[model samples]
Target: MQKISTCLWFENQAEEAAKFYVSVFGDSRILDVSRFGEGGPGQAGQVITVEFEIEGRKFMALNGGAPANFTEAVSFVVDCSDQAEVDRYWSALTDGGAESMCGWLKDRYGVSWQIVPSVLGSLIGGPDPEGAQRAMQAMLGMQKLDIAALQTAYDG
Candidate 1:
């Protein structure tokens, strides 16, 4: 059992969201689900919380009603090893979602995510300041990160 894990708040969609997440991530599954009891905040037997894992990382989802919502302040970052990996996650996550600049997107559930190449850190933090700046500039203009373009800017 993990000592600590992330929890997502939803409006009576914890089960749906957890299932969707499990389907999206190849290595994921639902661990457990707890339902509301009699006289609880929610209707009896209603889904209250769900426990799941994504790529080995455990996450909990709470059906805390419609009050709580997701925002851009907190986002999950998917570090992709290659363009193919980046495309896979980007396409799946943005299917019914909106795309934002700099490899950011808001999923149908309003959760923000960043699908970026693992090399981004290296290119933007390299010793060459000018190259790093170019890479940064290239990333700023991209919705979904382009590894080739970033490399070109880094090498320019």
Candidate 2:
């Protein structure tokens, strides 16, 4: 078991969210699911918690009550190898969701995710700071990250 796993609070969509997430990331799978007990906070026999993993990172989704609060203060950053990977995640996560600027998206379950290219880190920390700045500026105008466009800006 992971010493510390990230827990996500959902409005009774823990199982659904876990299934959706596992479908998107090939290396992910649902480990276990715990249902609510009789007279528990949630409906009896309903999913209360789901343990899942994506790329070996453990996560727990809790089917808490109504969603009172969820903020962008915390987000999952997906390191994509290329534009195809980025697009795949962005499309899957943003389905029936809202798109935010600079590759940020709020999934249907109200979880914020950042689908960023792996090369983006190196570009931002590269020797050419000016180029990186331009790339960042270009990225700010995009909903889904475009690796080719970012690369163009970096090369310019």
Candidate 3:
């Protein structure tokens, strides 16, 4: 059991969200699921919480009541090794959600996710400030990050 875990509040789609997330990340799985009992906050037999993992990081999805206040203040950043990995997650996550610039997307549950390429971090953390600036500029205009394009900008 991890000492710290991220908990997500949902209207009633915790199980669905957990399955969706586990399907997206190859190195992830659904650990456990707890159902609401009689007289609980949620309907009996309904999923109350779902424990899942994405690339080894544990997270819990809570099927709480109607969302009163949930926003994109915090998000998960996925560092993909290639464009294929990015595309896989981007497509699955943005299917019933919205897409934002610079590899940002909101899942159906209103969770913001940054599907970044591993190389992007390298470019941004490069020794040459000019190269990093160019890469950053290129990233700013992109909705889905293209690893090749970022490399071109960084090498320019």
Q: Give the better candidate number (1 or 3) by TM-score.
A: 1
Highest lDDT against the true fold, candidate: 1
Instruction: Rate residue 109 of model 2 by lDDT.
Output: 81
Give model 3's TM-score versus the native structure: 0.90
Give stretches of model 3 more than 4 Å off. Answer: none
* 1-156: candidate 3 lDDT, tens digit per residue: 689989988888889989988988778999999997998876789998999998889999988878745566788898888999899989999999999999999988789999999888789778889999999999999999999999899999
User: Any runs in candidate 2 off by more than 4 Å, and if so which?
Assistant: 39-41
Compared with the true structure, what per-residue lDDT tens digits does model 2 show for residues 1-156? 679889988877889989999998988999999997897876789998999999999999988888855679999999899988998999899998899998899988888999999998766666899988888888878889888888888888
**Model 2 Cα displacement at 90 (Å)?**
0.7
Best model per TM-score: 1
TM-score of 2: 0.91
Ranking by TM-score: 1, 2, 3
Root-mean-square deviation of each candidate, in angstroms?
1.3, 1.6, 1.6
lDDT of 1 by residue, 35-142 (tens): 989988778999999999999999999998766878999999998999999999898888888999999999888899999899999898888999999999999999
- Which residue pairs in candidate 1 have backbone atoms (N, alpha carbon, C) closer than 3 angstroms, thus clashing? none
Each candidate's clash count:
0, 0, 0
TM-scores, in order shown?
0.94, 0.91, 0.90
